[model samples]
Target chain A: MAIRYPNGKKYTPPNSEVKKRSIKDYSYSNRGKTLEDEIDEANDFYLQRQIAVIHKKPVPIQIVKVEYPSRSAAVIREAYFRTPSTTDYNGIYEGYHIDFDAKETESKTSFPLKNVHPHQVEHMTVVAKQRGICFLLIRFSSMERYFVVPLEMLQNAWTRMLTGGRKSISLVEFEEQAIEVKPTYSPRIDYLQAVRKMLP
Target chain B: MAIRYPNGKKYTPPNSEVKKRSIKDYSYSNRGKTLEDEIDEANDFYLQRQIAVIHKKPVPIQIVKVEYPSRSAAVIREAYFRTPSTTDYNGIYEGYHIDFDAKETESKTSFPLKNVHPHQVEHMTVVAKQRGICFLLIRFSSMERYFVVPLEMLQNAWTRMLTGGRKSISLVEFEEQAIEVKPTYSPRIDYLQAVRKMLP
Candidate 1:
């Protein structure tokens, strides 16, 4: 339902097959629900306990046309999905601005750098520079493993790629740089607990 | 354009005239653009200067049906505007979690409580409880006056209304409780400076 690709660069739209494939990028097979669902459940658990307040921002869409059939219900007639400039989820956690993107890959060996866009990387860099808690929740879906990769690690990978380095972060690299988060029943994915461990 | 009213109490959305009236409520006579524009411009100014990273969250919508007529463009055939559960604008400023709602009224003497939904107030209360900087950017368009009312003041007014007190906050109270912000040429409304003054 969300388009992660920047229009001209990675994904040129009007290609039905490619678009369909992009949607598959977000869907998880093992779990009945997606990784987004796990994070949402965790957020809900936190909100209920007043432990933290975080939310996935709405998918940005450019509304071109609206039909006012009746005075009350204005149905959106035409809208185009817009690539988000910032991360998907952000909120206040432990009096700090928390910003992160949740991504999952089918690959067990490496998570492609292309999964995280250039623009999002730029936003995360600015956020981390501002001393906000910025990171990525990456899931190796095949291995059923999740890791919270800090923005510093992401920025380094992104910079290295721009300089003609490897275009993906290896599993071994993730194990060293990122903190692994274990999913639990009540909170689903307790990434915040992992966040606490990472913080000074 | 925007429905500030909650569904049951203030707004019953199948009615056309009330909906049209609500659209008019968002429009302004002077400056042409709404107060939302002023805030957006200010946010842009802040962003350009690297002062803050604040953005308005997208309007929540219940998408009933979408049609992909072409390979690229997916048209929303049927959709309903859902009320936002949280404050619209939020981001990081000097490592602080910033959250706020922008509101403007035609009334010069008072700001109506009916404009703020119970659910939004509940959300704002939780935000303030988390020690995130939370406030309301209220514009009295009739008098060309703007004020940033802290969440504590807003909560007090909301509580008073809920307890059978005045349904609106008087201008006199706003002058005393809220910090007045002057609009400028570049930033449009430099409320962040006002925010800094309010913060401990």
Candidate 2:
């Protein structure tokens, strides 16, 4: 029987040929990976070196039906993805509570405010109030530029939007207010160096 | 088709009659709820009051198959429960990074060492080294007693067990090393008070 997702999309297992092709494509080109993948690689590197212990929170799901196919394996037969209440990444680094979300955009001129959810903004505000280091890692994929924008600046932009201002943050504002994070070979994205500079 | 859990137990949705009976039973008896439930309620109270931001990390699951049944929801058809790499609860309180797990035992004389997992112990150790507050909220349900045992004390007990010592921590040791946490109405488990006493 064919399986169905909550979004009414049919689930088709990737064929071996497609899998092989994708693997070859990814191995040959940096364009194959998303910004989130690069950040995850960086997190793994940081963890192995004991430099930091950050982790992306797992996607939350609400399970309605589960089937125990064996004594040790439970297969979820019905479940829905739930909206996450907080940002993607959070952990400790140098005794600081670190929390952030990585975002990618193809546009080079401005980042759309719609990319960020209001609840996430509220969560960041709360974390910051608790003295945690909260920020966003935004990737301008078209320009190949990455910036670490602190929660305060994001909040300012959000407020401006609420007051009938531009609905996006311009590249000019990003250059002035955000810290640039250069890409690296080993860790992939060394955004922490930018974070270290932001720390008081 | 009937659903089942990883343990091979059949999953039955609680009908309204069963639910009503359970609610009445719980309303009249203190035996109905688990320690974890009380702690969750307490965390909710704390969050509602803006006193703390602690949250129990959702159980991690490895999704193998998902099907779209509708445009708005994706139903997972096959998934397995994954072992979590860290403790259950973590968040910020009073500018401090707090990480802990709540454990309940029916033992009257001693808490069994088997209840704590090796990976969880290692995680607590790492968090402590990072200067984050890490501990175990252990409840002797039989005695209706809860204690906040610091990672240091837990490490000591684990080490003793490794050296062929008793496989459980005696109540006497708890009196000397652990801080007692009293239950309250709103924040069902006021563990932070115990945490405050542990802080320098």
Candidate 3:
């Protein structure tokens, strides 16, 4: 099946071979899927099972030229994708206000600060002060390791970087401060169990 | 200044005269602004004052074409706006998980049930079950009345309608069950204060 965009343009899937290979090999099920894709699948699992209702905020777009082909159908001829002003995923989990972004890094030794935007950092800071559950789901893709770093820890690192500190959080520091989330067949990345440990 | 899409196509703003007129009249501040826009501005006010961190999820778009006119600037030539799979606004407020949709109707006596989609109702139901705060910010535009109708109230009406009841919720029913929220200067629709009233 040919994947096409709304405007009838063809959309090429990123990694078709790897996606096919991963489905066949259960051991490497998590290999082909991107961190965001895995998290989305996990959220779907959670929603279907009535466990949680987290969702990734849609990418903001500025629509300019919209053609009404029919009375009910509006076709967008032009639009601009805008940067998100907040974190990606957020929802309720057992009465808790959960807010976080799922990020992936190729670096094995450190998670680069550049991967996160300043606005996101500021947003998370405010959310934390409001007593909401704010954290980062950082996945070191090369090493197949995932960590749930709390807002406070991220703030400390962010503050340090702004004041002439390291641009990245070292793996050593992540091991001590962040909670590791192991992958599962159903939820994919079962970070909520790790989140439970973070609650006061 | 003329508005243009990323594809360099001319863009027309909705309700241009009302928008232009509203900019001049300070007293009729919320005149031209849609309920969603008013809520967005209110959310901004809340965020800036450190009162809450609510946000409307961006409308999802399927991008089909892009034109790179320059090395750094990528222009979206074609896209399609998609119907949201979830509610519009959601966030944390004083340790509460807030989720809702802002809707406007010109009808004076009753608010039509067709304004609320099935997926949104389902989403709200799930969020309510998870113990998160869920409701609807309904505006009777002609009557200049606004109400925060809880998910339970909405559910009751929805169930009745599904079982061949009235297609609309009467003003009497709204007065009995829903919490009236008047428009204000800072947070245009002060629904959070009303939400606080609903909490135990």
Candidate 4:
């Protein structure tokens, strides 16, 4: 099932005819790598140089069955997702506790609210109140751009969704507050420079 | 399949004949809930009052099929587990970086080394090298005892394991190095007190 796009349109599975196209056919595409793998490699690159300590939060899962075919490998045959209660990445960088979730959206004009969960916003509020450095690393795939928007902006947008406003953060508002991050091969999404400028 | 108990014995599923016992029959037992759920709840409790901000590092999973029944629910139909690169819990506790793993054993006299992955010990050492507070919250069920053992002790045991020594930490060693933690309802495992006495 496709999720509702930021523009309130249903997203359908791309046809196999379109899927056969090469990486050049898609915008902001880093070949065929999944989001988690790319971000993980990026974080490893950052950590190797003692630049920062950032890690992806594990997706919660409930396992029901495991078949042991061999002594070395036990294959999980059944599992279900558990609702997450917080944002993804969090750690200390240069003595500042950094918290954020990295997200990529195909929408052109805005990023949808549904892309973010309510608990994640709540998590941001708690982190902000504790004086932790918090933000969301948002990527506009169609535009091939990434931005780090402070927690306050996300809090406001999250509140708006609660009060019957549009379920997305407008591109106009994001441009006003977010610090742009240029994509790189080594770190993939180099966000520390933006964090430095924001927190310094 | 059941893992081996620390006492060099395999766990046979509790007799199927005893399945009808009431909740009080096993009130003191580590049943009715899984270790992961307990850790997750404990982390939530710790985060709410600003006592600590620990979270389980997510295990990487390879997703193969996702079925969307409706607009809201997406069910993961097929996936496989992958190794996690970091420790289970890592966050700032009282201004000091705290990282650890909570492991339970059915043994009465020792905790098995096989329960811990080698990479996890490596991760803990890295955290300790950075001067972060690191420890293991180990629970022995047959004895109904919980202990917080320092990472140094764990590293020593892990090194011994590589040399074909005992693949467990004996009760005598745990009694000396591990701080006893009395389980509670709110935090379940109140480990900060141990932190205060040790790291502080």
Q: Which candidate's DockQ is highest?
A: 3
Error of 1 at B93 (Å): 0.7
Interface-residue RMSD per candidate?
4.4, 3.0, 3.6, 5.8
Candidate 3 TM-score over all chains jointly: 0.87
Per-model lDDT:
0.78, 0.78, 0.81, 0.71
lDDT of 4 by residue, A82-186 (tens): 777778787666656678887878788998878787788877776666566789888776566788988888888888888999888889988897888887656
Per-residue lDDT of model 4, residues B70-156, tens digit only: 666555556666777777777766556777887888788889888898888877666666566778888776555788889889989
For candidate 4, the lDDT comes to: 0.71
**Each candidate's TM vs. the true structure?**
0.85, 0.85, 0.87, 0.75
Ten contiguous residues with the weakest lDDT in model 1 chain B: B4-13
Which DockQ-derived CAPRI band holds candidate 2?
acceptable
Comparing only chain B with the true structure, the TM-scores of all models are: 0.84, 0.84, 0.84, 0.78
For model 4, state the Cα shift of residue B35 in Å: 4.9
Residue A92 of model 4 has an lDDT of 61
Error of 4 at A186 (Å): 2.6
TM value for model 1: 0.85
**Residue A153 CA error for candidate 1 (Å)?**
0.4
The alpha-carbon deviation from the true structure for residue A178 of candidate 3, after best TM-score superposition, in angstroms, is 0.7
What does candidate 1's lDDT look like per residue over A1-200, in tens digits?
A: 23433211122134332333445543432244467877888899989999999998877777776777766877776666677889989998778789999998879999998888888988887777677898999988656689999888888898899999999999999999889987665666889988886674
Which model is ahead, 2 or 3, in terms of TM-score?
3
Candidate 2 error regions (>4 Å): A1-31, B1-31
